[model samples]
Target: MEVENEEPSWFVYLVRTSKSALYCGITNDLQRRFKQHQEGKGAKALRGKGPLQLVWSQSEINKSEALKTEIAIKKLRKVQKEHLVKQAVRFDRK
Candidate 1:
């Protein structure tokens, strides 16, 4: 048996709901979590908000940092969250 050495990673993500609302969360497996949300099996606020689109994801973070970041983002108003997402997009393009 062989063990593959893969660095653990945490991510903070934002998704756009079918109704155009934003959803934010933290996950070690962004793809899986995103799929769960899209399938209506994730967050209660996200259920029935199908056709979700992953809009922003921040990687290279640890669990603690991710949790704190998630908490901070969750506390933001809708406009503030939108600003955060825009910042992420700009950062990614750099």
Candidate 2:
């Protein structure tokens, strides 16, 4: 018998706080995770950042890819992150 490796679907997301700050995270369910963040039950860094707005999300990625993408995005300068979000939003709308 062979065990097959299965990849979990994951998403890389960014939320903007009322203070105009960006938060980065990865989740299998973006909507639920965002709700938890809004409810102050998610990441401690984001707990007080409400009302949080889902600013960017990339889907159809596996867990590993999502984590790598999240780290890469987190390391970007704010301007670069903003540019990335803008670029992603443009593609999302298409």
Instruction: Report lDDT (CA) for all predictions.
Output: 0.81, 0.81
- Tell me the TM-score of model 1: 0.79
TM-score of 2: 0.81
Predict model 1's lDDT versus the native: 0.81
Candidates' RMSD to native? 4.9, 4.6
TM-score of each: 0.79, 0.81
Worst 10 residues of 1 by lDDT: 85-94
lDDT of 2 by residue, 12-48 (tens): 8889999989998999988899999989999999977
Q: After superposition, how far is residue 84 of candidate 2 from its true place, in Å?
A: 1.9
Note the residue pairs that clash in candidate 2.
Answer: none
| Per-model tally of clashing residue pairs | 0, 0
Tell me the tens digit of each residue's lDDT in model 1 across 1-90: 998765659888899988889988989999999988978889999998878999888874479877877787788789877887777742
Over 4 Å off in model 1, which ranges? 1-8, 89-94
Provide the lowest-lDDT 10-residue window in model 2.
85-94
Instruction: Choose the strongest candidate by TM-score.
Output: 2
